[model samples]
Target: MAQLEQFTTPVDAVVSRMRALDAALPARDGVAVFNRVYLTVTEEVDRRVGTGGFPDPRTAITLDVLFAERYLTAVEADGPDRRPPACWRPLLQFRRHPGVRPLQFALAGINAHIGHDLALAVVDACRSLGCAPAELEDAYDRVGDLLVSLEERIREELMPGPDLLQIADPLTHLLGSWSLERARDAAWSAARALWALRGLPELTAEFTDRLDAAVGFAGRMLLTPLPD
Candidate 1:
């Protein structure tokens, strides 16, 4: 049906863009590192869209696409003249540091996307769907669960081996400090707050700006370069 196609096209298009990024960037590029992880998650979401993975397929597709576009837009808009969201600035600025590990890059990217972009994306999806944040909670949790499931696998694939990741290693401490579960939880709270403030444009803008800066600060800390 045309109505279904209308809802599905954006999801497919965003997945295509991510796949293209995966192909174009070198394996070691920090953005590329995050792209690979994101692409995998997006592909899984796509495959599960109509297969009962989502209680409401249409809402899932809308939220997923909106959530992914924020990151893709940051990638597209990065430059000296253009500022990506504050939360995204660190990863873009430090993408090529030799001392920063792939795991750091991936998590920093995750921090930015979930910490800042996700809350806004929920608002965006709610507006597009003519619903409220609470209405989208199911879809949000489903997507968050998918990310949580992939996170451990991400660590296993990208983390340095146990021998290198000693108890005293700074990387170990840094890794322990940030948790995806916490970020996802905070994002839900922020989304609720943003939705509540939607009627007050000035307050909404200020809260969003503060959220962006705070998330960016966390990302900068996550990207701290350690001696090799």
Candidate 2:
């Protein structure tokens, strides 16, 4: 077997703790089970920042999305490649049931920044939580929906409003631009929010630190313009 040490995210520390959670889940097929675990995580930023969600924190939605994408990738340092195609596109789409959409979404979001391999680890973490990959999917969706709305609202209020695509082109669309201003604001807001979320007890320490560090790292990237 390949060594897991190659995986860079701090998630390794938390994976052990989540084992108990995984055991409680009922039997299910592997691929179906996997989808139940990763979707909808990326959508939180879309809901929260996309609409100019936050104010005091003053964040740029576009930038936050970028940061969020980076954070998702951190956990994937080395693992199986299971990233699903974008809702708009699909190299090979993973399908999850309606109840499991959130986890799958989150998984998709995380994989967006890194390789698909890390997604397997995410499933392992869910197992430790006493939830099947499916349950984690449900849990994450509910959590992402509620938190993202509030976070996005607060984030928009914190940062001045701007469009990100205007500044740089999208991977899929050359003509479309990503607004640099939005990227700066979103990255900053996400960093601060991550810093604050670090204090919460609901998440394991490993999960918190890995994501927190990722936010800071990505936020720093926002400082530099995307290389031409």
Candidate 3:
């Protein structure tokens, strides 16, 4: 957590923490696979924020920080048996599975983070700032666009060579089933729904739970172990 605490900007803190994880985890470890991809995206976002690319820098930074904290909190969980949100559980549980490919790890992590955590993080940012989801939509869209652009590059870099990525390959099918663009769309919808239901805490909680579970299920599918 020292790396997280040392940075003043939310993006900086996240970048530092991911770098630390990338250094600490085995190069081929599932978590490391995703961390390396994510670290690059975050660095790009940070650079964009610095350049005034985001329409609302303050809101963007706030939303980004809150979003990243959810993932980091899960990473730092102290109890070995403690399960995180459904979106996160698969990665945490199957990260070391010998049969899972690096591409699976990368996509699963992206799915969990964008499908579930991003929506919740939007709500968190709104609540913390005494604003509404609409106020933060600009920031959300900016971030989502960045993620969408980087996804192809991530897949290209992480996917096995063409010889191993045949049309009949299960990995090919699995990877094709999940798309960053779709996840981002779902997250935005979920965020809007959560904001609308904010007045009803119980309903909101239930909605959030359902969202987490659904994302987790998707992640589990993404992480399905494949034989070498």
Candidate 4:
């Protein structure tokens, strides 16, 4: 496993850590389930970076790496028994529950990362680059586009078979209410809002807390355990 500081490229380091997690965790574990989905997205972003898909490669890498570090840091900081953030608690706490399907796990993780972590990551990137949110808009949109595209495929791959999934199932309604595209759009908006309000630490902190709580509420809903 590569330590966070070992790699010069932030994306490379994130990809390495995610891959290591995939290898170490059981396939059905909630974190592992999300890691697999996220790993694919990171790899694609890395490919795009190699192929010159972004206008600013350096800025793109910086945003992508810093964006990922937020999640990695949370995981690293929370030892096996420690509590994660409100946004992460549902997935982490109910990871091994038999009633929680893979789709739930995947979506819950996505909710936490995209809705909560991504916004903060944007602010983190802005501070690190000493640039405004508008400056990083291209990189943000490109990364978001990748996530939106993959969201469908992840649902299709992880959802229970049609025969097994009934329309009346609560999971159906819960999943329907959450959209990755919507979340991505909202995250971008929140990032811009945060950037705009950075000068007012109290306001920024309040907005961030509200976002975290909202995302956590969604995660808790997504993790609603179903009957066998």
What are the lDDT figures for the candidates, one per model? 0.92, 0.32, 0.84, 0.84
Better of 2 and 4 by TM-score: 4
Question: Could you tell me the C-alpha RMSD of candidate 1 in Å?
Answer: 1.5
Model 4, span 130-204: residue lDDT tens: 998889888988988888888889877877776776633667777999998899889989998999998999999
TM-score of candidate 2 on Cα atoms, chains taken together:
0.24
Model 2, span 53-165: residue lDDT tens: 43311122222233333333433322365532221011113222322222222323322323222233333333334333343333333434454454344334322224544
Give all candidate RMSDs, comma-separated: 1.5, 19.2, 3.7, 3.6
Q: What lDDT tens digits, residue by residue, belong to model 3 across residues 148-181?
A: 8888887778777867745338888887898888
Instruction: Mark the 10 consecutive residues where model 4 has the least summed lDDT.
Output: 1-10
Alpha carbon deviation, residue 216, candidate 4 (Å): 0.5
Residue lDDT tens for model 1, 1-228: 466577788988999999999889989999999999999999899888857688788899998999999999999999878889999989999999998999999999999999999999999999998999989999899999999999999988888877775522788788899999999999999999999999999999999999999999999999999887
Evaluated at residue 108, the lDDT of candidate 3 is 91
Output the number of the TM-score-best candidate.
Answer: 1
On the 0 to 100 scale, the lDDT of residue 110 in model 3 is 92
| lDDT-superior candidate, 1 or 4 | 1
Clashes per prediction? 0, 54, 0, 0
Ten residues in sequence with the least summed lDDT for candidate 2: 87-96
Candidate 3 or 2, higher lDDT: 3
Return the number of clashes found in candidate 4.
Answer: 0
